[model samples]
Target: MFKSILVAVDGSEIGHRALEEALAVARVMDASVHAIHVVQTGTYPTLILSELEPPDIAQQALLDALDREANEFLADAEREAAAAGIRMTVYKRWGHPGAEITALAQELGADLTVVGSHGRGRLDRFFLGSVSSYVVDHATSTVMVVRG
Candidate 1:
C-alpha cells in the first residue's frame, strides 16, 4: 500500500480524474496526496514587463497564456482536493514538468505517482512527448498513467 502519493495536475479534466483516483487510493491507504503543477521555465516572460522596455505583443501573449496556466492548474487542483474532502498539499513548480514531478515524488517520499497522459494548455502528448512517459521512466516509485 502506498503511504505517500504524488498526483500531477495540469488543469485538465484528465488530470482531475487522475487526482480522483489518487485520492481514492490515498484514502484507502491513509496516504497523503501531494498535488503538483510544473511550469516549464524559460518559456515565459519573453518580453520584459519593465519600465525601460515595453512588452512585445507576441511575447506578452505567450506570457499571459503561461501565467493563466499556472493559476488554473493550481486552482483546479485545489478544488479537486477540497471536493474529495482531502486536505492535500499542492505545489506549483517552474521547470520541466517531468523532472519536477519525479523530484517531488522522491522528496515527499511517495510510494506511488499518478498523472494523466494529456493535459490542458499548449502541451499535448504528441507535441510535448508525454510528461507521464518521462516520469514513469525516471521515477523510482510506482507510476500510473491515466489517459486523458
Candidate 2:
C-alpha cells in the first residue's frame, strides 16, 4: 500500500524501463511518484581533462554537459509521469547515488522506492554492481526493482 513512490533514473534504457514500470504501478495504486537522478561526483570531473595540466575550458564544458544531462533526465521522467497520469515530484542530488537515493526516500517518507535492475549496462547482472542493487541493499523503504 504505497502512497508515495520514489523512482531513480540514470538516463539508461534500463532506467527508462524502471520509470515506466514505476509509473504503471503508481497509476494502479493512485500513488504519487518522486523521480530522482543522482549525479555521483565520480570520475566525470577527471574525465574532462585526463592530460597533464588540464584545460579550464574542457573542465567547464564537462560541468555544463553534466548539468544539461541531469536536467534532461529529470525532465524526461516528469514527462513520463505526466503521460502516465500520475502525480510526480523530481529531485537531483550530487553525491554517492546509493546514499542519496536512500536518504531521499526516507526524507520524503516514501512508502516504496523503484529502480532499474542495472543502469547503462546491457549485461549488467554480469558486468558490475548496479544502482538497483545498491538501493535494494540500502533503502529503508520497500523497493521494487524493474529489469530491462
Candidate 3:
C-alpha cells in the first residue's frame, strides 16, 4: 500500500541491501522509489579544516569529493531501479544523513522509509550514533531498517 518509498543509501554493503529490499517492496506494491544520499557536512575532517586559516579551498575540495561519492551511490541505485523497471527519483543532500533522509521523506510525503544498519555494537552506536536508529525514531512515516 506504500505509494512512495524513500530509501537512504550510503554506498556501504548494507546500504546496497537496503536499496534492493526497497525495490522489491516497491515492485510488490507498485510504488515509486526515491533514493537519497546525504553527504555528512559536519564530519571531523571538515570541522578540522574549518578552523584553519583560508579553509575555503580545502573545504570545497572535501565537499567536492563527498559529492562525487554521493553521486556514485545514487547512480548505482538509479541503475538498479531502472533494471527493476521501477520509477525512481534520487536526491543528494549535505547534512546529517538521518535528518536529511527524514526531511526528504516528509517533503515527498513518502509512505515508507528504508534504511540500512551496520549492526554496530552498542558501544559503537553510542559513540558514533546510528543513522538507521535516528531515522526510525524521527521519521513520521513507516520505517524499514535492514540490518547488515
Candidate 4:
C-alpha cells in the first residue's frame, strides 16, 4: 500500500502523463502525492567567450526562466490534484533531475516514485540520457516509468 507517492514533472507531455498516473495511483491508495520539478543546473554549459555577458548575470537569467517554467507546471499539477480531491505537495530543486528526485524520495520516505520516459531508442538514450532510467536505477523506493 503506497502512502506517499513522489512524481517528477518537467512540463513535458510525458511528464504530465506521469503526474496523471501518479495521481490515479494516489487516489486509489488514498495516499499523499508529492510532485517535484528539478531545474537541471548541469545541463547548461559555461560560455567562455568574452563577448557574452557576465557569467553570474547569464546564469541568473537562465535560472529565473527555469524557475518560471517550473512554477507554471507545478501550479497546474496542484490544481489537477485539487480537482481530484487529493492532497499534493510541490517542491522545486536545482540540480540533476535524477539525483534530486531520488534524494527527495528518500527525504520524504516515499513509497513510490513515478517518472516519464520519452521511450527513445538506445542511441537517443545514449546521447541524451534518460531521467526515468536514472530514477529507476537510483531511487530507493519503488519506481514507475510511464512512457510517452
Q: What are the TM-scores, per candidate, against the unseen true structure?
A: 0.80, 0.85, 0.87, 0.86
lDDT of each: 0.82, 0.82, 0.84, 0.84
Looking at candidate 1, what is the lDDT of residue 82? 78
Put down candidate 3 lDDT per residue, 59-125, tens digits, no spaces: 7787678789889989999999999998789999987778899999999999999998752234435
- Summarize candidate 1's per-residue lDDT along 40-64 as a digit string, tens digits: 7544545435668867888677767
lDDT (Cα) of model 4: 0.84
| C-alpha lDDT of candidate 1 relative to the true structure | 0.82
- All predictions: root-mean-square deviation over Cα? 3.6, 3.6, 3.2, 4.1
Q: Judged by TM-score relative to the true structure, which candidate is superior, 1 or 3? A: 3
Among residues 3 or more apart in sequence or in different chains, the pairs in candidate 3 whose N, CA or C atoms overlap within 3 Å are none
* Candidate 3 Cα outliers beyond 4 Å, as residue runs: 47-55, 119-129
**Pairs of residues clashing in candidate 4:** none
> Which RMSD does model 1 reach against the true structure?
3.6
Angstrom error at residue 138, model 3? 0.8
> lDDT value for candidate 2?
0.82
Sort all candidates by lDDT, best to worst.
3, 4, 2, 1
Which candidate's TM-score is highest? 3
Query: Candidate order by TM-score, highest to lowest?
Result: 3, 4, 2, 1
Residue pairs with backbone overlap in model 2 = none
Query: How far in Å is the alpha carbon of 110 misplaced in model 3?
Result: 0.5
